[model samples]
Target: MKKLILSLTLAASVVASPALSQTVRIGTEGAYAPYNYVNDNGELAGYEIDLGNAMCAEAKLTCEFVTNEWDSIIPNLIAGNYDMIMAGMSITEDRKKTIAFSDEYYPAEPSRFMATAGAKFDFTALKGLKIGVQGATMHAAYAEENLAAGNTILSFETFDQAVADLAAGNIDLFLADGDPLNNVAEASKGAMVAVGEGIRIGDGMAVGLRQKDTDLAATLNKALTSLKKKGVVDKLIKVYFKDGPFYSN
Candidate 1:
């Protein structure tokens, strides 16, 4: 975990606002495209950003986006580095033990394995293959717990590195969120393909908060519930994911 600099820690304290204030800082990892990522123009842009802004508006609060590295995002939030976290984070019981979560804004997305196109394997008899996963992620934990028995597990700091390694044949497969991996596979244009069944491991995605921030959790939940009812979340998912309005039911 990355430690907050003394100055940044003080700044975080200064920037922290009340639950119903006009402003709240939302921390995100700006590397997960279509969900949360930094654009070439050096601006935060994605489905989470749009949805978070809409939720803030619904709650009559202004939201500011803060980029944090994935490994440090949770600890930093607990350290008061940001008011809340709205990255493409799933709401799992394990995570709930560490932090509070608003009502889910996005449905649970399954995890899938990506491999170089034309690569074949007897997955049932799989052995001696290297699997790449971003470190400290649910996928990493899942892979370690389930797949490490017969394969070498390679942990990377970023999804891009894992994908690059896969493309370069350094790793046999890369496991990640299905939507983003699907997006990347499509962008690869026959270079990469998703293999294996979709693994559903957690609940839907939501805003992560300090476990004690009950008021803020309630405020965000109220806003998210309203947005879901209004179909804003569904529309935004379609805009970014080009897939299902998953919560329309």
Candidate 2:
């Protein structure tokens, strides 16, 4: 009787152990569509969400999606708010100082300017124009470093707001990733148009992990490589982007 009781207790402990719980928390900004967004059903959905789920499955991890603001995504990651970030975040040397990134899953794409239809403007020769960009992003950084001298660069908490300002004529132009900008243009029904060629920015997109979480980073890297080999990543990209500019190299 004593032996049976001990065996039952051990079994229960195993069932309750953390090792048996393989949940991986994935963080993302649910506002960037084609990458991540809240759908009509009020559920998180997009290419990154699909890719994250696939990677987690390939890595034998149970993933739970968590929505976070873009500005605080990195800080929250460092604070243990989530185990990984799959919010279309680009990998860059500056970000590398604080967080590690998985191997590039999405190839580096270009950024472009969008303005009201029939508005002729030179992106290279900007002067006395109000440009909008999402705060704390590469677009904002590029605008500040390259365009702020002669132009008015406005920062917003979300890309949607920046695009809204552009549509409302509050801003002269808005800069953002080609894929999302293309989506905005298509949805705008000729209300907006791309102003210039895609401007290449930053390294490719990848999963972000804490600097100290080397093991998790390695696991994600391996899984991403496997997914790439299996053509799962390419398939998802095609499904979302089709003949779009964003693609895997």
Candidate 3:
């Protein structure tokens, strides 16, 4: 019994140590705009990028971001290739089984819809319309749950590809956050529009952290809280998404 107790204590100590911490690599889907996406120069930009840099500063740690495919971001996180995920990932009970989340720092309504102009439709009225979402996203899960079982649900890697498929009439509609959908719609010159009423999923957006690094998660949360207080988060939201629906005009 004494030996077991000592082992448990030692294990706890290892989990709590920061020196054992890595370079704090963060994972993001560089394909999702406003939240995270590649800029014109092929550099990472968006709210997550800004918030992540601030968090690193607050934590007093060096950090780097890797553009990862959305479908496998969490899986790769568990595999130890990265330290945290901040791709506008939502805090959901379904995901909590494998990884932990910091307190929700940025929460907003999940994106939805992909209908052509002059097509009057309601998501509830369409009992058999097919929908597309990025695989492994909260939007994908929501589509699976809300849409009819007979309604086909497709998954894609990038939002741009999903929008392309929609424009080609390959799928009935695409679902994602409002910011990306709006960006895609404008870029397509009105080929698609988010028609159905938007839906909210889970509590809010949060950083996905390895289960073992609760301390690191706490540190990130502290940074997020500080940013929230200093109006940095709100300011960034306005700058990036002033004309978007999620933010006021």
Scanning candidate 2 in windows of ten residues, the lowest lDDT window is 240-249
Residue clash pairs of candidate 2: none
Candidates in descending TM-score order: 2, 1, 3
Which wins on TM-score, candidate 1 or candidate 2?
Answer: 2
**Tens digits of lDDT, candidate 3, 1-249:** 999999999999888766654578999989777889889998999989998988898778779999888888999999988989999888888999999999776656656686776666666666666788888887888878877477899888877788778777888878777766776767767767778787777777889999999889888888878877787777777777774333222
Positional deviation of residue 222's Cα in model 1 after best superposition, in angstroms: 0.6
Per-residue lDDT tens digits for candidate 2, residues 45-130, read 99999999999889888899999999999999999989999998998777888999989878888888999999888666889999
Residue pairs clashing in model 3 are 111-176
Best by TM-score: 2
TM values, all candidates: 0.90, 0.91, 0.84
Candidate 2's displacement at residue 33, Å, is 0.2
Error of 2 at 194 (Å): 0.8
Q: How does residue 206 of candidate 3 score in lDDT?
A: 85
Please give, for residues 1-249, the per-residue lDDT of candidate 1 as tens digits. 145687788777677755436568999999998889989899999999999899989998878999999989999999998989988888887788898988888888788999999889776766889999998888888889888998999999988889999999999999899988998899999999999888898788889999888999998899888888898888898899776747886
